[model samples]
Target chain A: MQKIEAVIQPSKLDAVKDALLEVGIEGMTILEARGHGRQKGHTEFYRGREYTVDLLPKIKLEMVVPDELVEKAVQAIVSSARTGKIGDGKIFLSKIDEAIRIRNDERGASAL
Target chain B: MQKIEAVIQPSKLDAVKDALLEVGIEGMTILEARGHGRQKGHTEFYRGREYTVDLLPKIKLEMVVPDELVEKAVQAIVSSARTGKIGDGKIFLSKIDEAIRIRNDERGASAL
Candidate 1:
């Protein structure tokens, strides 16, 4: 099985989720994160004062799918999350040795 | 080397951290999350109205560990996070091929 992790702009989360669902991908874990990347932080005004915020808010989506679905899932994310902007974010693919559903001891891809 | 991702109850965060530290695993990333599993969500009253909230708050801890320490690290987390209850959470292990520390371009396991 393979795990697809995509770090994306917060604003694009709903679209990405919908896109994945359209492709028949349902189960996923989402996390809130702060990302530091090529795009340097910018100054923003809050309460009439400017502050330099270095780490930008980001959303990370993680899912484990059967090997066959990896490519489709990645494409779904790319199409939905892209905004022609620098921080559109990144997708990472990795191999999962085993997956066990804590509830019923379901193992392997079925557990996913 | 393997990357250990643990989705655990928010209340167990501190104990899990201390357990990992005791086992010599230091660096880790923590994120806020919501989880849905066998332990179904319950209804809660808000503003004098009852609402069925399905997803529950969770904490996700992620770290890449050297191959030799995967077992030990998993043990630490299991021991610390387990509450003998329904939603104690789960751990996932995956293979990482090229971890790069964005700051200095460090690669491989060293970047972890």
Candidate 2:
């Protein structure tokens, strides 16, 4: 299985979620994260004071899928999460050794 | 400076939250992360599709702590997140070069 993680603009979450759900991928985890890319955060004005804000708010989505579906999932996320703007975020794919469902104690590809 | 991440049972979240709050660590990001172990993702029936789902639902908690408090945080998480069950999840500690808070631009220890 592959663990697909995407760090994206928080605002893009709903669209991404809908896209995934439409693909019959109903399960995913979302987190409010702070990170940066080549832009390395940015400057913002608050109360007339310019501050070098370095940690941009991001939403991270993690999904575990069979090796065959990895590309489909990644493409769904990339297309949904894209904003044609800076801080669109990035996606990462990692290998997973196993997966299990705690509710019923199921394991292997079945537990997912 | 430890990024303590716990892949745990979703039900354990409330208990873990109380524990962390008790320790004065209120900031954290929770992601629904799917993973497996020696147990792996298991099988289930959804309308008898009997199709294999390779992703198991897991909760992932990430926190940035001071070097001095790494042990304390880890211990708190380990104790709070433990279920003594097979899919209780795991914890990982990784080095972070820098962190920033976009709202205020606080960096490093302060941002965490």
Candidate 3:
């Protein structure tokens, strides 16, 4: 299965959730994250850079879905999370070896 | 590189973190999570199930490390986080194509 991790603006959570649910994704794990976006570098070590380092409050949405739904899920996130601004955030894709549900030891897709 | 995600008990955060640091992993992203574990299924649809649905507080630790560190990192997490109980949580392994530091656009291993 493909795991989709989307780091997005905090304000866009509800809209993104609605969009995902509309596309048939119901379960997801949401996390509050600090986004290392561009901020002013305060020390000499990073002073010369074109941009500074800053951490913005970001919402990370994670879910593992069947491989076939990867592209569709990505589109749903990007379209809903984009703000035409630099801090719109990013999405990372990866492959999951297996998934086991702790409740009943259910494995694979059924567990998901 | 591999992305190691451990959904562990909130109380084990400190110990798990120390374990990672001892193994040379310094950077990580932490998120607060709610874990769905066996609780009394309160609704009709889930009432007859062997277990119920309840959300427990969990801490999700995320980091991308060099391929060689995957095994060590997993061991560090599993060893420190296990409580010999059902809610100790689970660890997931995935392959990351690339990692980019948003602060300055540093990419790949350098970013990680």
Candidate 4:
């Protein structure tokens, strides 16, 4: 399975969540984070607020899906999370060696 | 070194934390999250409330540990976080190409 971690604007969270759910991706985790990208140390825009600092508040959505669902998931995130703005955030993809459902000890895809 | 991301029940946070600290593994990023497991859309148990929505509260513990501490850290988390019930979460391990601490530009393990 592949792990998809997308750091996106907090304002776009609702839209992105709905989009992911619509794509048949039911399981996901959300996190509140602060960071900067290429536009580091510049004024950052978020939820109608502006901050002239190196780091800006970001919402991170994380999930693990079967290999085949990676592209669909990424597209869903990009389309919903995008604002055509620099602080729209980035999506990271990585390999998950194993995933175990803590409750039942199920592993791999089923676990995801 | 490996980046360990564990999404577990919020109630287990304290125990998991102490376990890692006891093992000399400190410095972890904690995020408030909402997610669902195999059951997908259903009732969720969080901090003392009923979540009848599609998602449930989860605590995501993330940290990068030196290769030598990976096993010890994982064990500490697993032992403390498992509840033997459905809401218990999963652990993901991934390769981290590089880690840079911005303050002094410390790289690799130092960054972690």
Candidate 5:
């Protein structure tokens, strides 16, 4: 199985979640995160001493699916999370080695 | 330190939270994630065909700190999240280029 992770704008969370659901993707994980890309961090003045903020607020979404569905899932997220802006965020794909259900003690794919 | 993320069992979340709090790591974000790895998912009986599920439920945690605090933070997570089990999940560390606070428009490290 593959894991699809996206760091996006908080306001875009609902739309992305809905888009995934529309594609028959039921389960997903979302978290509030902070990061920066080409836009870098922004400048701020606090008590007159200019301070730099390197971490920007972002929403992290994680989902797992069979290997065959990886590409489709990525596209689903890209289209759903896109805002045509610079701080739109990024998506990552990774390999999962195993999975288990803590509640029922189920293992492998069945645990999903 | 850095961005310390862990994909761990749901049952272990509270314990981890308490541990981090003990160390003065106050702010964090958590999400419900799913994945399958070495265990490869499991078999289940649905109607007649034994369908296999590959995704497993997990909690994703993200945090940011100064580069100097990386090791201490990683240790905090390792000790807090350890259960001596096979499906304990994984942790990843990466470099972040910048950060910004949308509310006040702060940038760089101060955003953390």
Candidate 6:
């Protein structure tokens, strides 16, 4: 199995989720993160003082799918998340050795 | 080496942290999440309306560990996280090709 992790703009989360669901991908985990990527830091005014905010708010979506679905899932995310902007985000693919459902001991793709 | 990701109940966060610390696994990332598992959710009244909330608040803990520490780390989490309840949560192990610390150029297990 492959685990697809996408670090995306917060504003693009709903679109990405809906896109994945449209492709028959239902189970997913979402997390809010602070990312310092290639995008340069920008100065912000806080309490009348300028502060450089290096880390920007990001949303991370994670899901484990059968090997066959990896490409489709990636395409779904790319199509829905792209904004022609610097912080459009990136997707990472990783190999998963096993998956076990904690509820009933279901394993492998079925557990996913 | 492996990456250990645990989806646990919010109330069990402290115990899991202490358990991991006792085993010398200090670096971890925590994310707030909503999970829908075998544990049936309850109903709540919001704005004077009843809602069947199938998804419950959860805490996701993630960390990369050396190969030798994988077993030990998993044991620490299981021992501390188990509450003999339906929603005790689960742990997932995945292979990591590389890990690079964003702050520096450090790589591999050291970056962890």
* lDDT of residue B49 for candidate 1: 55
Deviating ranges (above 4 Å) for candidate 6: A39-53, B15-29, B35-56, B66-88, B96-112
Best by TM-score: 4
lDDT at B85, model 5: 60
TM-score of every prediction relative to native: 0.65, 0.53, 0.56, 0.78, 0.49, 0.68
Q: What C-alpha lDDT values do all the predictions have?
A: 0.77, 0.67, 0.73, 0.83, 0.66, 0.77
Better DockQ candidate (2, 4): 4
iRMSD in angstroms, per model: 3.1, 8.0, 4.2, 1.8, 8.4, 3.0
Output the better candidate (4/6) by TM-score.
4
Output the better candidate (3/6) by DockQ: 6
Give the winner by lDDT: 4
Ranking by DockQ: 4, 6, 1, 3, 2, 5
Candidate 2 residues lying further than 4 Å off, grouped into runs, are: A40-53, B1-112
DockQ (C-alpha) of model 6? Answer: 0.33
Give the interface-residue alpha carbon RMSD of model 6: 3.0
- Model 3, position B60: C-alpha lDDT score: 85
Per-residue lDDT tens digits for candidate 4, residues B4-35, read 88998888999999999999888899988877
Residue by residue across A1-112, what tens digits does model 5's lDDT show? 6678888877777787767766657556556666655644555333455434556667787776667777877787889889796667788887654444433344445544
C-alpha positional error of residue B6 in candidate 6 after TM-score superposition, expressed in Å = 1.0
lDDT of 5 by residue, B54-80 (tens): 445567888876677665666676777
Candidate 3 segments whose C-alpha is farther than 4 A from its true place: A38-53, B1-4, B8-31, B34-56, B61-91, B95-112
Per-residue error at B104 for model 1, in Å? 16
- At residue A105, candidate 4 shows an lDDT of 60
Q: What would the DockQ be for model 2?
A: 0.08
Candidate 2 lDDT by residue in tens digits, B3-112: 66567767789988888887778889987654323432554333344323334556788888777876666567667876666556655455667889999988998888
lDDT digits (tens) for residues B31-69 of candidate 3: 888544432343212223432234446788889999888
